[model samples]
Target chain A: MDLIRKTNTSYLIFLAFLMPIMIGADYFLIQYLFNSEVEETLLHEEERIQYHLAKDGDLPISNYLHEVTPIDKGFELNPKFKDTLFFEAYTDKNIPYRLYSFSSSIDQKPVKITLRHMLPEIEELIWFFFIATFAILLLLVIGLYLIHQEIYRSTWHPFFKNLSMLKQYDFSKMESTQLNSSGIREFEEINQVIITLMEQVRKDFQNLKEFNENISHEIQTPLAIIRNKVVHLLESKNLNKNELRQVESIYQETNKLSKIGKALTLISRIENQEFKRLDRVDVSTLVENILNNMEEIINFKNLDISTELQPMTIECDHILADILFTNLINNAIQHNKEGGWIKIRLSTDTFEITNCGDVSEVKPDKLFDRFQKGSSSKDSLGLGLAINQKICEIYEFTLNYESKEEIHTFSLRFKA
Target chain B: MKVLVIEDNLELLQDIKSFLEEEGNICEIAPTYKSAMGKIGFFPYDILVVDITLPDGNGLDIIREVKKENIDIGIIIISAKNSVGDKIHGLEIGADDYLTKPFYLAELNARIKALYRRKAYQGSREIYFNEIKIKPDSYEIFINDKPMNLTKKEFDIIHFFVVNKHRLLTKEAIAEHLWGDHIEMADSYKFIYTHLANLRKKIGELGGKNYIQSIYSVGYKFTDQEWT
Candidate 1:
């Protein structure tokens, strides 16, 4: 940011310096050209005055040249002193003539007028130079302004305009938002730095995923072995009723452990990006299907599920969407009081699943954080909403939690 | 009744086979999908126990094939994938029961018998557990085969307790099993007490042994030991 600011400031300053210098040079030349033209006008007057006085009266020509008063300081030469002003003039060399300049102020003063003829043409040259210089300076300033705009459009605009995309980049898809090679060495350097940081982050994430997958697989096999062996021992016919009950406790604990492990593994996979995008899913149908299977439990718990389903379709990762929906629904069903009421609503692109419960023990903002339970419900691992939030992040879906009147509502809105 | 158990694991298969045989039911074994498909094709067994993750293909596919052949077979899918979708899929594909793997043989056997009862009589039979007998079709209960008047909920509570006997049942599980998932809204187990009270009064009036034991802060248990 500082570098861009520096470049922009330097460009502006260079243009600023160029503009007034050119303008001042043209202004000086214009003043010089105007004064010279006035001097030529007075010289013509001097000649006419000298001729008229010399021919018509007894006054000497030198006296007449000196007698004309200066009109103003516009001309470099004073009208009275035009003949006495130093100048160079030339005629064809074939016609040689004696040249003299008469001094009008001093009696009998000889004044040379040889170079006075060239003064008018030199004045014209000065005028043309001033006009051309002024025109060029005006054009140059305009050109600089346009060049500044073009540079801003090509460089600064793109750099600053697309910066929000960088801000909103989902860290899960780090590789997808990689910067294209800008060809500019400075930008390329910055891009390389960003890519290096992202690559390191990606590598760390990969290592974490590998670690989690290994842990899950390692723990799973042993848990599975233990569960099967327990079942096998229970059926061996050597155990009495008391022993069987003891074995039952082991099975229950194993079941809970398996559940926690499965949730953890799923979370890691979500973190690891092992999900695929499938067909567009009708969320209403998915919710209905889950609810149908949950019917037995719902009825047994005496919960009332009121639904307002709309025909809505969303292109989503089926596995992630399933996990998201199931976890939310199961959480609602698991944490509520018996005979609780669950209300579900679906619009064209929004879904709201609300369940009545006591959540005074929880802050709503922290509800989506892992293992933050609002209640001491044994079945809840509190990873449900966190996993759901993660899935939402992966798919760019939005999940919002709102509580009102003791009703907890999870709202999911799909991007169009 | 003969049950054809199709599982890839030899020890678990043997355990299930022995456990069922001990329960006085004939047990047949098939270790691979091909063998299970072959046995299912030729054998007229009462129940077909299938493990979903087979060496050849999914056990759910076999269930579909059997259904397509118009064979009235009772299939119980046993899988290590305890995902809700897997269970729902297995059952939706015409499997009579879905049991997650590493389940006790007793649980498997119980599911098989439940499937048997469901398929054989379409849930119309008088099931007996010692002196307590239940006629599900008529929603009737009897002690020593003598009729006992019980309320609707009392009968349901007893039926659930009897079917899931010798299991550590949580209050939530019991409530969900009885009322539905909606039981999450129930303030307490006060209604459970009401149902148990009604059931006990009816059974006591019938001069039957009282087996209901309140497991303080947990749930009630019905055992044949104390009852006898």
Candidate 2:
């Protein structure tokens, strides 16, 4: 906005300086032409008077012409007298002697005239030219002001108004005002810059929100474990050999608490952009590791397994990818019914896992939301899908889930 | 009933183990995801006490794996997260119970018992402890096959005590639980004392021994004193 205002001011100044100079130049040119025309008339009259003086013996008229010459010179000599006066004396030959005085003190060189009767008419025309010149200059000033106003309306005003809208731009509202029409190149460039800045700010705000939510969710898990264990220890009074069992539960809850802390720190690191180590990761090996890790769970549930595979490798942050898959595959199996089937498939650059589970309670769009899970299971943090989604976004991979007839499917398609 | 505890914290895990061991139940421990997976695979437990955050992986993953094997093991998800969404997710994934951290160990025991009851009885609805049999749905108490007439408050108090037997229930929690949401504005807890006294007297009149014991400056514990 400040820039816009400055440009407008400079443009107005340019117009302010330019108009008067142009008007003054035109005024001087017209005045010069009028003065020259008056001098030419006076000279023509002086020639005719000299011709009459030679043709007839009219020394009296000639002498009078000579006397008016001194008055004409005095008109030039007297600096205060601004106007020129001309008087005509007509001889018998109808020739005229004219005194053309410009309020100078030099009167000896008064010019004679032949057409002396037209002196008043010529003088009126010169006076009219002066008046017309002044009028034209006034009109030019008014005309330039109007033109300047139109320029502001068409260019600077709209641009500045559009820029003012940017002052109110807020990402929380997620609404942007439309830019006004840019009639000139400078305004267009400014508008583009403002729009780009606004978009960047909005994106940063969204990232901040996501980061905060993830941090809180990660922290809560450990806190919950500690709380539950403490409550259990304080409340239970049974001493019938279940004491060892109670100790084990408390120890388990404590361990969970610590793990939650670690996870929170890990998530914060990711949000804060601390870790950026990347390598060419073997997609097959990563998937195999996660599956092997979950082997005990697979056997315990007696779930039938099926797979399709093609050798594939990809470059990515291996640790995060491993965590992402571990969470997702674990969730799929945990939420399945007894004797359910889990299918794992891998390709050159894509991997997918599907399992039999109840997904009726989950909304598809909200599946990736932290702590959002479908009915068929309890005791989940719902962080798996969220983590998976985050990893996908970071790696530029595409992750999606589909549920149909109790079969929940998760697919991770790597970008080629 | 057998319960499996899979948590990594040694202190909290030890506390829970001792408490549950005192309750006449065997609890197996698996501190890491690998060990937890092994226990879930090789062992048969009536209830699995699991946490969401685990060392090798998340406890949720273990829950999911066990669930897929179709093991009829009852699961109680113990999480530190208190998000409504987390609670819903755990329950949705077939966990019979979800308890947030900072919860009482006694509550977990109750939930474990509830899960067992739900799994075994399937709403046939009776909680039996020695000679005392309580019908939860009907709120009736039968001692030595004889129905004992008890007041509403007395019956409720006795039922709560029995459900959370061998557990110390804080007085404040008891008051709030009994009064529901209105507990916040309660001026005094004298009424809880009156109800407890009445309940004990009635049970004593019926030739039943007192099971409720007061812990100094804390709360009440209900357990078979003679057996303990």
Candidate 3:
């Protein structure tokens, strides 16, 4: 799957196809050359026999030329000769021979002469050359593959380093990323592009953060002004009943508006990673404090409360953790029925709060969404669970909600 | 007590000025950082209520200038930003208290009174409404020189009422004052009625005059005079 393996496999396939063709060509070439040399020697032997018969009027005895017979009559008038191969069984191993047969005259008489040469030595030489060529080809392929592997590793080292750096980059830190120059043009180009892109992204993030802060500040001041004015009007002793009702309605609506504004701002801030200070926050202590603070509300409704908390600690921003716990507990208390029971269980890695309430009409999937209020509660801004979910996301914690059998449960699972 | 309020919004400035003035404190208003700095340079005041973001300059600079003069002026930063950084920064630079915007005027009044008490009086600052006396630090109350049993929240409500005497305290404001952030998620402000009733009952049982009057559908007003 990797580059080196793919290249090596292809190269091996090519060698597999090329090796046999090379060996076959060498075999044929060595066979042809050896056959020609045997033919030459046979022809020279024939010529010498003829020369001896012509000079001394008798044929010279030669070991290479055998089966020399003088044809007295009915000898073939044709003097054609041909070279052929035959098996010689006189030795322990049957060996092949190159034999040339021809018709000639000895002492003015026609004679048939045949010369044969064994080819076992040339066969052995061909085998040796075939094996040596195969070995060389194999060594060449292996050496090239190893060289390629080394080059690949060294060449891609900088690319892999840059990849890991990109993976570990955290936008919240806004620290500029430094990439080592690999001296490779393509890799350097990639690093430059990434650096420019990240810089732009950081700039955009900063601008959006500032804009959110400014908008929140701008909106809150006017809301405060309207609220204070309404307060002053409500304080007057000279207002009619209708006017008083109007003032009270205005004041209440303004309060809701203020809450929504604050909740939105808090969500944006969390998303922006503004709360970055982390500390060892004890979960049990925070839940206890919140429960204690809500005691009055529980008493007002006469609801039964129970807590099963184990000592648990997580590293997180303290204020955000407080808000997270506060929202969960507050939701449980606010949604519970009068005289209902509430239960909280905290373990080493999880916290769950369940309360007896009417079966919620809001869908489970839409529970953590902003402005998703229960059908019965008209006063809720519906931002409580949303804020809690955002805080959980910031900490990589899991927040889940379920409602069944007239009971509502919210759970948080912290990552260790 | 004399106070200087530096705020950009005219209506809010007027409201704060009128409310504090009605509470029997001499209140002056500066609509910008420049005027506020000019006023502080020439005048001595008991408290400086500054909004952090001003049109001319930062209210923090005003705080710096006031502190540089060593005038012993109590500073309460009232800003719209609920940012923890800003609050910590302001407090670190000697701001006595920080109140986020959209706060109730009664809450503001209580914070100002508390700040003034802490700055002007080292300890032993007791608030009196007719014969009812409240020791805020010790969370104790006396009616006609006799001690009365009061819960912490009861003590706080009465303390708030006594501090902002004769002012209408909305139920929402009282809720926020009692339960700061939790009040937002509260289903209703009806719980305040229980505390209010218990406070009135305890005060009445102590042979004290009933000064807490509910203004029918509006809120409660605390005063020394009897109302029908």
Candidate 4:
């Protein structure tokens, strides 16, 4: 259903429908003209026959095309034309003829005269006319169609180009959606409208992004205040056990609130693409460093850890790279069962981490959404996978998750 | 140790100053960026804990001001922003350390002490808690004048507890201090409990009294107090 094909199909249908109508019109026109010319010749021949009879008061010599004959008649006759088929002794088949018949008085007596013209070539003439007219009209239509196709293709070239440009446009990556103007006025108008709309959208998006970032930052101060106040309360020796528990709960929640705020800020920062420092980061080393740091936690869980790593280096933001792997490794460690196993494999093309955790009911894709954790781990912030997904999207890597029974696996494929 | 805390928020400033003063360090306070600038070079404070976002001006300018004065002062930036770029920028401009906001005061105390020691001692920075001695520069701790076989994580927990002595340190605070961003939103009490138990056992085996008090299910407090 492209523009070109749609128009071309309609044109072809029009031509197909026009074919029979044009042929029928041609047949009738040619027949009318042919009949008129034959009628004129027949009338002239009849007049010559009458003249000869009147001049000598005798019958004229008979011929196949013209015949002078006498007939008993009670009334005068008017000339009439009729088509008939005559049998020829030599050909042994009927040949079509146009006959003119009339009665005339020869020697003051009534006589009948008939004039016939053979029309053996009328079928050939119709076919010839049909082929000739059809060929010419078809040539005209096809020529026009081809020329229009070229014109339409060139005319809509910029429209399609603009479409492709729109497909690749991203608000986070670019500040403007400037489009090239097509020479045509319609396409130019469309491009201008898109550019104007994108400019407005960029402004609004910037305002919202800055607004969120500011809120995230400003809220941290109050959270810090609350945390410090709670700590002070916890330090009070006169406070009873219940009061200590209450203060400790407050402290813990404040920590969680701060963590959630920081995580949200990190996601926004990634969305804003604020981390622009790209370097050749060694993935293997980052993994090793994170593993070394989490060794105590892993050991405490009694998780059997194994790694198969090939030295992999990729162009990435150093901090983002560190956060990405650290989050993934923490996820693997956090969700594991006691005395579970963790298997990690890393290569230049792919990185995978599989751990023995509770059976997951959430799908792999939805697990990457914010506040969507694989299990009902109430303390988990559920933003770790979301952040990981955002990082992978930024770096053009493919991150996937799968669970088989109790084994949860996360795999990341580096773009080749 | 004389420390100047430059923070716009009076409430946070008072808490930090009082806490530090209780730790036996002389604490001076500035409630605004202008007040901080007025007091920058007037006294050679050993440490200047500056909050980056102030009502009047940027705290980084204060660090620049301190550096321009050419005084041997330790700078620690406390900001709500956790951006590595900002952290690196703060560190590159002569700040000794960068601590994110909403952080535990205990963690800040530890950083301040570590920075103060590194500034004052100039190569021999060891902290003694009763019979327990810790050399932070080289991850080693000695109990009762003999080195104790302690893991890195055990050493970190004990060191954190020692620096923030007599203060209530929550399990979340310790995890965040030790594992940092790596621990994230996961409840890291298990990690803290495992390492702490090992640290207590090791210190007790080395003939050191149990100075660490597990405050019920809430947190732990390190002080010279017997179990009640």
Itemize residue pairs with steric clashes in candidate 3.
none
Cα error, residue A416 of model 1, in Å, equals 6.0
Candidate 2 — which residues are off by over 4 angstroms? Answer: A1-40, A47-416, B82-89, B128-134, B138-160, B171-214, B223-228
lDDT of each: 0.67, 0.64, 0.83, 0.85
Give per-residue CA lDDT, model 4, range B109-197, as digits (tens): 99999998888998487898889999997889999988988778788888999999888898888888888853464547867876777
Task: Rank all candidate structures by their TM-score, best first, as comma-separated numbers.
Answer: 4, 3, 1, 2
Worst 10 residues of 3 chain B by lDDT: B181-190
Tens digit of per-residue lDDT, candidate 1, span A1-416: 66546666676677668756755676667666755665565566556645654566333344213222322323243223232333234543232212223323222332323223222344555567656765776676667667776876677654664465678766655464667554678877887787788778877876777786667544654565666566555434466668768876786577556656666677766766666546688888999988875665566579999999998778777767766787778778876777899989999978888898776477888888877876657545677788888888877888988888678888888876
lDDT of 2 at A51: 59
Over B1-228, each residue of candidate 1 has an lDDT whose tens digit, in order, gives 789999887867876787688667889999899998898888888898988878898888888888898888788888765555667788898888777544544456557777888888888867777789988768888897788876555676777677656443445445545443211223335557656776777788888777776643345666665411
Candidate 1's TM-score reads 0.61
Error of 4 at A253 (Å): 2.2
Q: A1-416 in candidate 3: lDDT tens per residue?
A: 97778988998999998898988888888888877887788888878977887789776888777577666666574533454455456655665666667777765778877767766565687788789879989898989888888878898888888888889887766578899789999988988999999999988887887787677667887888898888777766688889889988998898888888888888887887878889899999999988777777778888898999999899999999888888888888888888889999999989999999988888999998989988767878898888888888888999998878798888899997
Can you give the lDDT of residue A283 in candidate 1? 88
Error of 1 at A24 (Å): 3.8
Pairing residues by index, what is the TM-score of model 2? 0.48
Name the candidate that leads on lDDT: 4
Residue B141, candidate 4: Cα error in Å is 1.5
Instruction: Output the better candidate (1/3) by DockQ.
Output: 3
Which candidate, 2 or 3, would have the higher lDDT against the true structure? Answer: 3
lDDT of 2: 0.64
Question: Could you tell me which 10 consecutive residues in candidate 3 chain A have the lowest summed lDDT?
Answer: A79-88
